[model samples]
Target: MPVPATGRLQWTDVPTPLRARLEDALDAPVTDTNTPAGGFGHQLAAALTLRGGRRVFVKAAPDADPLTAANVHEAAVLQALPPGAPAPSLLGVHRASRWTAVVIAHLDGPHPDLSPASTDAEQTWALLDKLTSSPAPAPYRAAVSATPSTAASLHGWAELAADPPADLPAAARDRLQQLAELETAWPALACGDRIVHGDLRADNMVRDHHHGVTFVDWAHATTGPACIDAASLAPQLVLAGHTPEDVADLLRDHPATATSPETTTAFLTALTGHWHRNARKPAPPGAPGLRAYQHRAAAAGLALLSHRLS
Candidate 1:
């Protein structure tokens, strides 16, 4: 399933004054703009080509909201990235009464497909393999782990066991008690010292023609279990229309994830619950399609679990 850019802001939506300011921060005149797709819930996402033939990726949000801090966090982390980091370089940042934007060197690549047996899948798996070998830089290590707070976001099964949603699947609704029990152990299981991309998925990554694989969206960067990021690939592969069995085969060569079935199941349960819960909520300011995406993601998580548990 393709993630939509349904509600994210377009380059044309930016006010003229603010656009001029961004160009000023870049110390270059903006010559063209392209809104990159795969905007899960980002408020602003686009690539601005500079007068000097440079292209920079930009992500921004309305200055008054929760995402305001996240956009700033990305800029800080991007700027502080250590040598040999797998991410792009931060070029500049801008904040005003209306919004905040962070600019980084644009990665010229195509988004990797998560579907099984494709070249994109192989490339993505290979990239995750490489990420498992590289330790998070000192700056990334200091950044918070997304697992604990993310764990707090899981409310579906518990809420359903008490007050079920009308659209909840019969299988899921019937297994609420099991889900509630299984969900409790994920946070402890996810704890570790490596930097997990925390939000690993095809959308947050790209395969560069030259660099091979490059990651975007650093706001979720954190230190956690070495396999945490790799563990996420299975569910995402399912979402990309692969079966859970195919995902299992994909994991055979993935040591970071293959070594622990218990941990993976726990991770999948917690993540499924998170998406299931959030999907039922009101859409955020700029993410109309997010709930729909979450619903699909939750289904994938659930499917992956069924196969793994069987």
Candidate 2:
């Protein structure tokens, strides 16, 4: 959650030509629209209510915006999702003039809160369990150009060991040497064959009476160990008030993380470095609270890693 708050485009911001095109794709006139907010950064997302009373979700962004590529990729990924995957269906995409808009089945649900025992938590666990059961589809396996990975960038402890940040947590600074060595094994430990969501957190998930559980935003989908996404969710749950141990106890039965103790430790260790670095830098545009959130996430990760390391 950013502090200045994510600034969203209005439903009116959809160019007249684009809106008309979306109307044609849906075979109905757009009567009204509502903006939906969840992610840390803003993209143009809206629930369009058609004149015929059908509702669909659409996301649009200009080529100039970084999210346009992701929007297009998400549409393609959703279209090819495996059977029974808990996600929205792509209806169609309207691409013109370096602007792109993707329309999909509207999913109604509240974002998950990682609170222990919360219904959101229960639903999200189920969603992860279901998703992890499937591998990345053919398109993902045959991707022509790999998206630049943040995995390589998560090794901040190496830099911190070389030049410790003034705000570095005392616990981390005390064990900088051990952290430096632990991080070296991270990239190697991360190797796996299962498709990973890469980014798994409350904002990327939703649950409703109808759909049961749904995960949105497939931009970070990748071929990795099944354990990666579930393990990634661990720190977020801790940040949401679950103790690290509690999360571990809960995830014990998950096939993904069920046998990957060292892998989980390495991933959390790298994330500790990831957030530790980002939290100390200038906040990115349109995301004022991101740095603070990263710091908190780093702390949660450190708590988890400490237990494993001990």
Candidate 3:
């Protein structure tokens, strides 16, 4: 198994019989396997060479757990997409007692290494337009509805403010308090019933030579306000060198990006505050990236708050 630097379990050689089954199911021989960079998800893709020197990328999630439902929902989301949508096509799904796997048509594109100059922001807006405009299919909606809401999320702002983490810096702590105030004031923000990517960081996007943009990692797909997806991207956008002003401008210009500036600001602030609180704690076994994520989240929160206050 390729152990991740964070000590996460990663891809390893598949048992011979399982590998043969996968090859047969994919209708191609796996030639070269390469570990792609991404989160803690148990997924891997390989380049396959077919008869005429043609190549395709084959991705599999053999270790999908209860999260398999999310993958299944993603397949349904892909199935419901309109023509020319920038995401990959769902190829196949195989399920067994202990695991589930999904195969997708290969997308050949550069990982959208987001930069101030990169077209990621523009492309992401276009993709959001497509996703929010279309209604989520039944299965996807059901899957989202079935998932349990986190207690922190359901408790709303007052509770969050009253219980701010003690370890955060004073500045970050103050910002979190402000976030609670804003969330309380703007408690009635509209949440649309549309299919949201739910996690729209640059890492999940690719810019192919043929396909201008393609999104992956659909495990977070949900039927919620597109604002949540936008909020999810806010931290990553900051990490990618976009200024808070840039992000705010995008949100203001794109109606589907967020419900309102205050709502977006509150969401980003709360998200970062949560991360900062968690990161101050001792690192969990096998989760070194948590600290890095915390720092990034804090930076994102502060940047957004600074812009909003200014």
Instruction: Name the top lDDT candidate.
Output: 2
Ranking by TM-score: 2, 1, 3
**TM-score for every candidate vs. truth?**
0.86, 0.90, 0.80
Write out the backbone clash pairs for model 1: none
Candidate 2 wrongly placed segments (more than 4 Å)? 1-6, 137-140, 143-148, 251-253
Quick one: how many clashes does candidate 2 have? 1
Off by over 4 Å in 1: 1-6, 12-18, 80-82, 145-155
**Candidate 3: regions farther than 4 A off:** 1-12, 42-64, 134-144, 148-167, 181-191, 282-288
Pick by TM-score: which candidate is best?
A: 2
Every candidate's CA RMSD: 3.8, 3.0, 3.8
Angstrom error of the Cα, residue 162, model 3: value is 5.6
lDDT of 3 by residue, 1-310 (tens): 3323453332244445656666677676666554556554544445455555555544444453444566766776666555666678888776544455566676676688667887767777777777776666676566566553231252233554667656546665665556667655433553557776756776677777787778876766656555666666666778888887887677667766545566666565556655655666676554457677767767786677677666
Candidate closer to the true structure by TM-score (higher is better), 1 or 3: 1
Angstrom error at residue 42, model 3: 4.2
lDDT (C-alpha) at residue 106 in model 3: 69
